[model samples]
Every structure is written in C-alpha cells, then in structure tokens.
Target: MQVNLPTNLLRSFVAIADTGSIVRATDKIFLTQSALSLQMKRLSEIVQVPLFRREQGTLVLTVSGERLLDLARRILELNDQAVESLDSVGLNGPVRIGIVQDFGDEILSGVLARFIQLNPGAELQIRVGHSREIRELFATHLIDIAVYHSVERDEFTVAPARMVWLGDPRLADRETLPLAFMTKPCLARDCAIAALEGAGRPYQLIVETSNISALRVAVEAGLALTCRSSAFTGHRLPAVELESLSLPTYFIAVMTLPSAHAAITGLAALITEAIENIVSPPFDLATDCPIKETEDA
Candidate 1:
C-alpha cells in the first residue's frame, strides 16, 4: 500500500527517536505530549510498521525506526541546505572587505573560511592595513566593509575593540617604563600615549616602528612596551608581561559609502556575526591581561 507522511509527523518521529522518551521528545518538538503521541501514531499507521518499541519504562527505536531515523536526518539537513542556498543567491556577487592586521591572522581567517563555504560563488576581495588606511578605504567606497580598532571619528557606528599591552617581564619592577610604539597616527598608539600622559606617569619613547610585526618583536626583546588588540594575544615568543589596559572599548563598526551598493549591508552582517562568534566567551572571547596601574608602565 502507498503511504503518505506529513512533514510534522516525520519531524515528530525523528524527535522521538533521537530523544528516546515521549516527554523529552515533546519538549524537543515544542508539542504537547498527547499531540506528539498522536503524530507518532499517525506516522506508524502510514508506514505500516512500529517505529518504536517499549523496553521496560523507556522507548527504544525499532529496526524500522532506526532506518527512518537516517532518512529523517538527511531530510532535515537538506532542508537547511535549501534555505542556505536560497539565502546565498543575492550574496553571490563580489564583496570588498578591509581588515586590520591585528585580527587578520586570528579572528578574520576563520570567518572568511566559513563565509566562503556558505557562499561558494561569492567573490571576496580583502585588503589588510592599519586602521587609518582601512577607514579611508571605506570612506572612499574602495571597500564595502572595514573592521578596525576604535577611533574618534564622526562617521561610522562604534563596535567593541580589544586592547592589550605587551612588555618584558623584567621591566615589571622598573622605576620608569620605556615604551615602543607604532606611528603616532595609529589608534592604539595614541591611546597608549594618552593613557600614560593622563596618569602623569613618566615614560620614555625609546623606539618607534611603523611595522606591527617589528614592533611586536621589539616589545618581546624588552626594547619597549607596545599596545595591541587582544586578538593578537596568541604570541608564542618569550615570556613577556601582558597587561590588559583600560583603554576605551574598541568597536568594530560597519562603514559604507553614501549610496553604497545594497549588498554591502548583508556582507557586513555576515562578517559581524562571524566576529561575534569568534570573540565572545568560553571561547576566550576576550583575553585576560593585567592593566597598567598608572598607564606609564
């Protein structure tokens, strides 16, 4: 006999098989116990087989139920794939993204990987630079979205930024701290200087470097203290003293040109979701580093 099963009934059956208890399955499917039972009954009637058999007080999937469970999982997975496929149609075009070097190696790599998997046909053009250069690119419509450190700008909404201080442990007890910094124009460098100045702490600017990697090396060599976002905290260099400074919260805001392409917003949303997933919690969403007591160190 030919049998037809409703989608809800199939879903209920899957839930029951997976959960192994009527009460628990009801919770999983968000249906009343009686309602779930009725659906299960209808499924068995249509299939002309017992999907589950009771063993003592618990329900176990029968041989037929096990076969159906495999089909159910495949069906659900296909349903999800279908939805994602539809969502990706508008996202198939090119999207230009600008990201700072700090997060480029750590957080953005995973996000880009997942985005490509989800939208295989989508074209991505990424540019990496310091925050100011990235911000300028966004303003000029050269890029669709830009992620960077927090800065004082009239344009763009603010998102949270991670900040950290790196220095040599030997300097922990130094009377006066020496600092190595990026160009004065850099956001993190400015914040580090301002924090020290505001705290009335005396610090010597011993070394200045325009390159982030070189500056990191300088800090590791105990040449000077350097500040960076928490995203760059995965250094395996020597034992450097890591201080979590209480700088202004950095925000990764979305920026688009006036009359920008409509697809930019959607792309920004995708990027933002990826960042949130990578940075937030038990994930070590944020790093724990000691704050500079007087900002001078």
Candidate 2:
C-alpha cells in the first residue's frame, strides 16, 4: 500500500515533534491547533502508525514518530535547499534568523523592518532566545543566521562591546547584593560571574531563570541584579546606572554556517553593518595609559 504525504503535513509533524504540543507547534508554524491536529491525523493515517500519544497533557512522539522525524527533517531541508537554489537566482526564500532578547525592541524592530524593505522577496523567520539557544538553532541548521552575545567559541566571529551592570534604583545603594542570572552557558551569565569574581565582590544567587523576561522582572522587583550590554538597556527598562561593576568590554557576533547561501551572506552583511553603526565609536582603550617621562628629566 503506497501512501503519499503532503509537505505541509510532514512539516506540521516535525513542528509537533520539536515543540511537543499542538499549541506550541501552531505558534511556531502560524497554524491553528485544529489545522495542525488535522494534519497530524492525516499523517498518521498515511503512515499507518500512531505518531504521538498524549500523556500528562503533553504530546509524546512514538518510536515510529521518532524515526519519521529525522527523515522528515532531511526531506524538508533538501526541499529548502532546492528552493534556496532557485532563490539565489532571484532572491526569494525564507531566511531563518535568531536573535537574543536583550537587543531592545526599538532597535530590533527598526532593523528588521529595514531589512524586509531592503529585500522584499526574502521572508524572515525570527526567533528570540538567549545566545546559547540561538547558537544551538544555528548549529542544528534550524536558523540560517544568528545575532547574539558572543560565546567563547573559536568558530564564531566576534563583535566586542562594553559590558554594563543594570539594576533597579532601589538596589543601587546595596553593597553585597543578590544577583539574578540566566541558566549556565549564557554569555551574559558568564560575564556577570566573571565581573563579580574579578572585582572580588561577593554576591548571592537569588534567582536562576532561563527566561529573559523573567530575569528582568526579578531584577525590577529587587530580587536580584543582572549584567548585560549597554545597548540592551538603552530604552527597555527604567533608567539604571552602572556605578558599581567596572567590567571590561564584551562582544556580540553575527554568525552563519560556513556553507550558507549567498542570500544568507548578504543578510548577515546588512545586519552587521546596522549593528556596527549603532555600536560604533567603541570604548577608547588608549586613554588609560600614563604619560611617559621626558629623557632629559
């Protein structure tokens, strides 16, 4: 019995597998839950096996489903590559972009709008997450490009900037404070810890969260303090001073797979130029040096 599967159905299956829920997958693919469910059902019927089982209100992929997930991803990736080859001829394909949440709304929104206008044929699939998660997306070939805080990886290109500590005005006077931080492997978390350790300033870990919004909420509520790039703090939260922690310059980078398409390269160039223009006239390191004494003296 030969059964044919639709590309949209397979794509929905992959989304459901990746997200583990119809609602979440629908959000990812911009499909309704009912539509996604119908696709899943059609897919199961075609494959002659149950793809997912509901347990504890979550969808769990069965063994057959797990096997199909890998194949579906490869098939879809190949299809995308074919479309991208056609896109290179005329510049008309989706460019998956991953961005860190810290780049304030205004800058990100404006940049994206301009990018869209600049390349009308290109569609942008934007994902907002921490630098690490974004990196994973890039590594897994899920996203074509990423703009995120630089990780200590030899593979990525670095764009360095001055790091700053941001906190509520209420916590500005406190000496030994509780710190709010994201999960491990985050560049911001690493920089925050390194700054505290370098300064010999002891701090308590008040809240450890993976959510950027939640971290901001904790910091605003005086539950903890956080370290982020100054660019991120510009217009998002309340005005906060960077009086305590004197951290060295940090970096964020735009990364893409080495074998990515020419359109990806073009988009990366556009994003890099925009970010560099915004963060230019970087901190001057030459002024810190002492004046040399004259030879006659």
Candidate 3:
C-alpha cells in the first residue's frame, strides 16, 4: 500500500498534539476549526486507526497516536531542513510588520531575532501599538504585515482567544468594579467597558496606559481588574469571577499583502509559530483558585 502523508497535515497534527485542542492548534495551523477538524479526520483515516481519545474530559493522543507523533516530528524536521537548505527561497527582503501592544514582549522579540538569523539580509521594521493602529498601517499600505485582534474572523485570523478579567478576586466584591486598562482606541478597554455597562455594573477607570506591564502592575497591586485576552493568561494574577460581565472572544489576526517573495510567508509562519509556542492555554474556570505564574504575560 502506497500512502503518502502530506507535510501540512503532519504539521497540523503536531500542532494539535502540542496544544491539546483543535481550537488552540488552529492558532498556529491557520485553519478554520471545521477545516482543521476535517484534516484530523482525514489523517486518522489514512492511518486506519483512532488517533485521539478523551481522558478526564481532555483530548489526548492514543497509544497509536503517540507512535505516529514520534515519526511525524522526525519527518517534519527532515522536510523543514531540506526546504531551508535550498537557501534560494527569496526569504530575504525588506519587511514591515505591526503588532499589538500585548505582544510587545518576548513573544515578538524572540521571533524577530529568529527571523533575522534565518534571513540575515532581510531588513525589518517593527511597529507595536493597539490593534486599530496596526490595522491602519496595513490599510495605508505602510506595512507589509499586521498582527491585530478583531471581532470578525477572516482568512488572516490565526487564533481565537477568550477575553478574561485578570486581577485580585477581592476587587470583584466592590460595589463598583474598578478597571485598569490600555488607553482609548483599544479593543480590550472598549469590550471591558461595554460588558460592564451592559451588565448594569457601575465601574471606575482607575488606571489607563498603553503599556501591558503597567496593566499587570495595577492588577498585581489590587488596583483594578483589567480585561485581557486568554493569550495573556499564564500569570499568577487570578481571573476575577464575574458572571455578570461576560466578555467576547477576540480573534488574533495576521494580514500579509500578496507578495512573490517568500519573505512574507516565512515571517508570517514564524510569527504564528512563536505565538503558539509561547501562549499558554486559556484560563480554566475550575482554577478560580489562582495558580503560580508559569511564564511572563
């Protein structure tokens, strides 16, 4: 029997295995949930065995799946090495990219450094700001790529993150919710305010800044509860319980203009891979009991 497995399918499978959910896996795979699910089904059919199983309500690899995973990693490593050894992929060129403030941390720095190492000749310009700012840069054709959050899902969406309120749980008991968020023109701020208003919860904005570190500081100080995406969840700060204020999921989108050069493709792939590698899974409702900070937000 001659059955050839596609590298793309292998990559998606690896992503799912690493992230433990089709949804989180799609963040790096760049496939819609339905499409990713189809790929999983197809991959299972090719192997003629069940690949995944539920254990304690969480999806995990079966024994057969584990065996396949070991082989998949080697295959992917060899395939990627061969592709890179070609060295004439046109990955070197000037590329301008804008990303949201939340990603101004090690996530962006590490990826940018890696991209520069891979394509030493490539000139890079990075802009970090609110999603609206990044979108504007992309819209004006001032940037080749844009990373931002959006309510609408499109071909560019790489990840869908649940909105979470992170801070001292004690703050939630206040008569008026106190908020510390990014300044105006920010999606998190707007959503937090809207959710509060809709819930008829009176709130006061105590701290406003464009810096995520500042927000974390305020949250750490028990100043206020700040709204953030699940992408920022791997910290010690507790997720403030507030069923009255339900936040919406925001899609982390990436936009790259059409280009003949592989620079855009290479950079975009690195960005998604970096994000998937760094972002911890979204907060679990069961863990209202705050846990230790595993990583910097």
Candidate 4:
C-alpha cells in the first residue's frame, strides 16, 4: 500500500519519541493529547504498522516506527528547508524583539535560532529585561515585537501559564516564607504577595532584584522562594510545598504596534507559530491562546 504522511504528523511522531511522554511531547509540539493521538492513529493507518507499544508504562517505538524515524526526519528537514527558502525570499532587515528575562532565556534562543535559519539574511536585536521594561521598550517603539506575561487581557495572548511557587527544598519549610523576586512592576511578585496576604500566610521579601537570574540564584541557594510560571521555572527547582498558597494564571502574550511594518508583522507571525509549537499543549487556538494582531496597550 502506498504511504502518505503529513509533515505535522511526522513532527508529532518525532516529538513524542524524543520527549518520552505524552505530556512532555504535547508540551513540545503544542497540541492537545487528543490531537496528537489522532495524528498518530492516522499515520499508523497510512503506514499499516503499529508505531508505538506500551512497555512498562512507557511508550516505546515498534520496529517499523524505528525505521520510519530516520526517513521522517530527513523528509522533514528537506520539506522545511524548501519552505524556508521559498518563504524567506526578499524577507530582510532587522526585527527588534523584547522579551521578559525569565521567559526569554527559556524559549528565546530556540525561537530565534529557528527564525534565523528560515530568514538567513534577517538581523535580530533581542532585548531581555523585566516584563515591565520589555513593555516599556514596546511602548517607546524601540521593539517591533514584545513577548511578556500579563494578568490583564489587554494584549494578544500566546498561552496561559500556571504560576507556582519555586525554591530550594531547604527553604520550603519556613514559617514566614522568604520571597525573592524582581522589584516593582512585576505581576508575579504582586500576585504572589496578594495570594499570601489573602491566605493570611506570612512572608517577607528577602531579595528584590531587577532580573530573574538573581532571583533564581537566591531560590537555588535556599535563600528564598518566588512565584513564576511553570514555563519559566520548569523542573529546575522544586515547587515550594504550600497547600495554602494559591496563585493566579499568567498570559504569555505578543505585543505589536498597529503601525508595525510588514516585515515586523511577518516576523510576529513566525514568532506566534514558533511559540505555539513549543509551549505546553492542550491549547485552544480560538480562546485560550489567541495569536492575532493587536494594538499595543
């Protein structure tokens, strides 16, 4: 039987195999588990071979799956190269993008790498700082695009991130939690403090720096705990054990001015597409994560 597999399906297959779990794979591919499963099923039907086998609670590739892996990767490489070569024609000039420090360090490198690979001639000026500063850069027209987290629904949201407490385990048992965070104009800091106060839980700000690196250092050294998105914190630090601590959801958003040039707009679309593929899955393109043009607010 002739076999035909879509590029997206192959991408999902490669992601699932690489990540080793549906949850982590979904996060990498930015697809719902159901959606991913559906793609797998369709691929299997086309190939007439089982691709995955459950072994000791792990998803293992079948022999056929293993054989297809190499082919799939090569095909995808060629496909993407052709697409980039075609799409990148005449796409030149610098694209200034501002991003929050925490989120910037996590996804910026990979995002920019892919973008640069596609637009080889394009120049990238990446400015990393606090979310407030990033927003200010956008407002001043210093940046063509801005990626930051917000509590308010004023911008084009890319995804919803769960805010959680993270710190060294040694500091998790404190009666009055020691907080380490960026100074004023930080939504996560404000949200964490509000939650603690609302729960009548005592806490103190032990470290208030202008960046996430210092906050991360403090948290890693058992100096204090801080609130950040799972996207930002990842599993690098343990989540602070606090049954009483309730935090708010943060929106990872893309901000662009209405007067942005076509190149800026195209770059923004690339960013949106890249973010959708990299962020944790179960995203709804219609409501949960709206990737559209919006005026800077």
Better of 1 and 2 by TM-score: 2
Q: Candidate 3's residue-wise lDDT over 1-297, tens digit each? A: 799987777878898999899888654554688988899899999988988997886679999999999999999888756655655664543467888877667566588888888778666657778898888878867677888888877778776667789888988999988889888888888888898889899989889887778887788888888998655544566567797798887777778877424666777888877665544553222432223558778
lDDT of 4 by residue, 1-297 (tens): 665687778978998888777777754454678988899999999888999998998889999999999999999888646544564363454467887776666567676777777667666667777678788778867677888887765648877766788877666577888888888888888898888888888888889998677777888788888888665554576566687777766777898877655556766787777666655543563466435555999
Best by lDDT: 3
Q: What is the C-alpha lDDT of each candidate?
A: 0.67, 0.72, 0.77, 0.75
Q: Residue-wise lDDT of candidate 2 within 1-297, one digit each (tens)?
A: 666776678888888998889998854565679988888888998889999999899999899999999999998888777866664453455667888877635346677777667677666668878877787888877788888876442445445666666677666567776788878867777877876787777788888987777887887677767876656655355545645567655566788877776767777787777666555344322442223545985
| Candidate 1 regions with alpha-carbon error over 4 angstroms | 1-93, 152-158, 235-246, 256-266, 277-297
Name the best candidate (by TM-score): 2
- Model 4: how far is 17 from its true place, Å? 55
Better of 2 and 3 by TM-score: 2
- What does candidate 1's lDDT look like per residue over 211-295, in tens digits? 7677777877778766775555455433344343356646565575544344456556766665554442312223332233445
Please list all clashing residue pairs in model 2, or write none if there are none.
Answer: 161-250
TM, every model? 0.53, 0.65, 0.62, 0.60
Clashing pairs in 4: none
Task: Give the runs in model 4 whose Cα sits over 4 Å from its true position.
Answer: 1-90, 258-263, 277-297
